[model samples]
Target: MTRCRLCGSEALESVVDLGATPPCESFLAADQLDLPEPAYPLHLRVCTGCWLAQLPPLITPEETFREYAYFSSYSASWVEHARTFVAEAVRRLDLGATARDAFVVEVASNDGYLLKHVVDRGIRCLGIEPSVNVGAAARDAGVPTLTAFLDPATGAAVRAEHGPADLVVANNVYAHIPDVVGFTRGLRALVADDGWVSVEVQHLLTLMAENQYDTIYHEHFQYYTVGSAIRALASGGLALVDVEPLPTHGGSVRLWARPAEAVGGTADGAPPARTTAGARGRVADMLAREKAAGLQELSGYAEFSARVAKVRRDLLRFLVDAADRGATVVGYGAPGKGSTLLNHCGVRPDLLPYTVDRNPYKHGRFTPGTRIPILPPERIAADRPDYVLVLPWNLRTELLAQLSYVHAWGGRLVFPIPELSIVEVKP
Candidate 1:
């Protein structure tokens, strides 16, 4: 982009350009396969002014989420993670004792994966989601949902109808919006004047450190470090009170914030000073760590492009070597990140042949740009491929256990991010 989206600065610097590719989640159907598909430039730029890493808003959220294919409930571990988060939030916020009086709202709540727990506690809850199909699924699960995107007007309407939320939970969706400031304000509008807002986004520090370039897709218009996150929240009159490093989606940060008014400042106005006692020392410590990692300046990103190139080269080498040896290699998951990795590495059906996923929505479709066929998980054992390329490597631990049965026929698994590695599994 010519100017940084957050600060409107012209001081944008290059981080990495992963070439052009189609929207990662735009899986093709059998009939549409013969038609031409569009691709967009997938370049990530960092703003010196705000230190916010971002991509051009080539695709809108409506194009990606209107009929979304991802369902959070498909992953058993993710479900348990949501359950734990809800239990902890209830105790931490004392919502359980006043369940009848409390209301929880989750932005971008896919299929009520997290809000189901709130419903179980008898606390009023609502999911604000844009995808009609997934929102329908959430309602069928008995979780109240509003099928709409969260903008300032929508947020205000929700507050007017259901009243302000006691807690607003936004997980993994903060980076998905291009209008960072507007979305944050929508968050502020939805939350109570004395309520809390919790956001979980992939931390840029770990993304660069762990070489997680595949996570950069059209859907995620921006990336954030702790310092940048603080600024983003401040733009919406929310004060950062605390933050916790999480192990989800490679690496993430669960930020605990509140209305600036609740944190001893004016709301819906300019951000207040960062010296409030409500601001914990952990926030400062994380900022120090980010600065130590060279995130505040361009020095931290100097070597990221090279590291990303190495990943592309190493993966191609492995796939080529496997093909020459006449070994069968199928893919494990059809995650959006997989599209970036596959397209960036120039992998096609010839190299991967097909992939499998637990989610049935993608069963009869093909991956976005690579056009790799997606099948049911049972296909892995049916064909007994010599090697299975794991796409959602962020879930390394969980997938290892689920695919342990691959050991039956001397099969192995390949993980391609943070360097390529092949491992034998035992059940």
Candidate 2:
């Protein structure tokens, strides 16, 4: 029996099965154009004991992130999101005058998107990034970065060199590690006696309720709920004291944690009885709702898969009909989840023609399995396809706003997940 990666519980029930899919980032090479692609089982399961949602094992970090291609700097929205996070974090930590020279460390810091904001305030910062290409981008952006994965040993080295961090930020990367307990322990070791660690991860409850099963790829080893996160941190000598909901990446939670002794003590060395009751209550309610929805049953996922198949059929029918009418259809946003959706629906070059991505590195490459070429977003304006399919449907509002120019040509936008529909642009 497959056991839960977090709590080692054998009580895992299949939540969704996306069938065989290529690796999310395995963009194809030109020379291997005709080579058949390999697909792995894309399945999600929930641990009954800890309430962690995760995919059945496929790839490891060494295989996935060693020379990663995705860069955070490519997305304007993501850059703005990082800036906002830095501002809020600095204010909450009271680092303006008191800790002017305080050190801030970010684990899995992608392309120095967040660190640039912290360093602009004259705060000393370091970024630990495993991807060489992305780490180089961080350095180019004037952020000091170490190209290595964060672990207990690396944490010790960082402390010996840069001193303990006053604040540590890990965004959207908390679920990427296989040894999650060990990773949290490393964060505990690097944090100052009074320092705080903040991590943002996709919310499991939202993933299930919204039928976001496509996000369950091999790179994400564990999906976290606040209850499971608190337990995991407590095991590593840390405590979660606060939670904030963020709208980025479908739905996510920003968790604030610190060493157990750091709580109930002020920066001025006084005891305070502050509590995070509101955040805790919100999280508890979400967990209860998930349990009531039968998240622990295999039948629940079978129904979900059935719905997904219906979406696939409907999308294919629409695309075939559009093609019959000589309507050109192309895809926007070559996101990881977009890859999952494309593969699950058996989309090929004949259906999508090509796709456009904001990331320059992904441009000029072909998507795996489908072999659909990825071009720059500018190509959308130049080509002016009859219908533009927004694969990352969660970002429909943002994408539609950005691509409003299509309206001038009387073009319509299509959303292919959850359902296939042509949406009218609202003024």
Candidate 3:
């Protein structure tokens, strides 16, 4: 019954019902288990009005983010990705020598993993992170951060204090926001007249095409295709300038936007060719590809619920078979996606005994409802488990390299999503 977050329309269509699952980030400690845990409807809906796919946040940002457990520093690959973005962004926006006093803002900046690189380059940067402990950590690392959630008002306050931002960067943080219009308007508010806002979101087309249902957790309120994203940005006075497809997060798109008012120039009777085409550039092509893949139509989503069920059954069969044979199976990372996948697949501690995380904050905590023990990597080396289940399959390359010790003991790696992929052990 919830209204669509994007178009403010009641004409919403159900995409999939992942059933009720606990808030993905609410990792619990042993003592906390005695208390009742809250779970919410993980139903996803699509807006017929705007064709945007989204989920009702089910919980407030405060409930989901405050005293957060997820940290970006845990992933070496993600950190490298951030570093690369900084380098390319400086070149793209000409932020290096010319835009010296330019203020760069990162929304939901975690542990200053990305901004630290910007600051190291002597560029002025600010991180707007909502999680208090996470913001303090960013500040501790010398990335000036505001301990506040981003909205239109927060955006105004930051602009008044620090002046307009030359470049506003939000990597994978935009999807987590429920009031994305307000968040986008905020980006439009603080961006310099001619400046641009850059965002990275996992493409919805990719999600549907690849059957990545594990990613449909409650923390992420929206998934965007190029067309839907451009429409949302246009609502907030921003226009898409260009887009680049990325390999990160299964498949993601990096969008560049400028003030809507700044799109057209005085050179002709109409706007520039790029601006006239809704500033499509390569973005129009991407949108056409999405349309060709049937993402723009309603029928594209109808089959997903059945697809999710089949994958769940497949994963359950694998885990049950492994357990019956007395083989050990442990998880690599207890991420939000992992929580959804585990709960959706009805995986319990018996099938997958425990999971390991690099973050010390999560080491003592247990996965939401499954109550799988979150342990340190040292435990894996100690136990030499027969099979290691990689929950964060997006970082499999980095994780496989780190967990190579398991292979030494005749162990193998397992991936559940996009079908079961068992990494072959090299002798």
Candidate 4:
């Protein structure tokens, strides 16, 4: 983009160029193998003024989320993670099972993975999701989901119908929207004046530190450090109150915010007593860590491109070596990040052969730009390859256990991000 999406600043600096790739989620059908696939530049730029790293809005959300292929409940760990978050939110917010006024709302609530926990507690909850397929799954599971993107108008209408929500939850979706300010305002519109809004997004600090460049894609329009997040929240009339570091999605931050007036003060009283002691200190500490890591300036990003290059080189080398030795190599998951990693490294079906996933929707499809066939998870056990490349390395622990059966056939699992590492599994 010519100017920053967040601050409209022209002082954008190159962070890393991941070359061009098709929208990561656009899996191809067998009938369309010969059809032309469009690709876009997947370069990342950071605005010096705002320090928000972003990709140009090459593709729209409508193209991706309308009939999304991803289903959140497929991953057992993620489902449990959502369960835990729901319980914690309910307790932390003092939401009562029988309280007639208590209500919760989640934006981009995929497949009711988290809201189902809210449903179990007998607390009234609603999920505002954009994907028709996933939203149908949510409703089937008994979560009240509205299939619509969260803009100011939609949020207001939801508020009008359901009344103001006591708690608004947004997880792993803050970076998905191009209109950051408008989305934040939508959060503001849905929440009660004194209610809370919680957002979870991958932290730019951890992404750079761990070489998680594969997470960068067109759908994720922006990345945030706490410093940049605080500024972005202010743009849509929200105040940052707390921040929590999470281990989900490689690394993430849970941001707790409220209406600007709620944090500052109400008209009739001083600021409502909140968790100022712990939250303010944590926010300060995280910001300090970001600055010390040089993320607030250009120094921290200078070597990122070099580091990303090494990952691609190492992975390609491994695949080539395996092919040369007549050893079969395959892939484990067909996640969006996997598409970025595969396309960036120029890995095609000849090297990868095929990848397997538990999601049936993608079983007969191909990865967006890489065209690697996606098969069912059973394919791995049926034709155990010498090595299996684990593309969704962020779920390392869970996947390790899930694929441990490969050990029966002397198979190995390869992880490509944060550095290349091959592990011998124990069945």
Q: Rate the local accuracy (lDDT) of all candidates.
A: 0.93, 0.80, 0.86, 0.91
Number of the predicted model whose lDDT against the real structure is largest: 1
lDDT of 4 by residue, 376-412 (tens): 9999999989999999999999999999999999999
Check candidate 4 and list the clashing pairs: none
lDDT, residue 137, candidate 2: 88
How big is the positional error of residue 87 in model 1, measured in Å on the Cα after superposition?
A: 0.2
What local lDDT does model 3 show for residue 326? Answer: 87
Question: TM-score for all predictions?
Answer: 0.97, 0.92, 0.96, 0.97
**Residue pairs with backbone atoms closer than 3 Å in model 1 (clashes):** none
Q: Worst ten-residue run, lDDT, model 3?
A: 265-274
Better of 1 and 4 by lDDT: 1
Q: Runs in model 3 with CA error above 4 Å?
A: 265-279
Q: What's model 3's TM-score?
A: 0.96
Worst 10 residues of 1 by lDDT: 266-275
Clashing pairs in 3: none
In the range 184-251, model 2's lDDT, one tens digit per residue, is 88898789988899999997767766667667777887887766677667656677777777887788
- Misplaced by over 4 Å in model 2 are 264-274, 288-302
Q: What is the lDDT of residue 71 in candidate 2?
A: 85
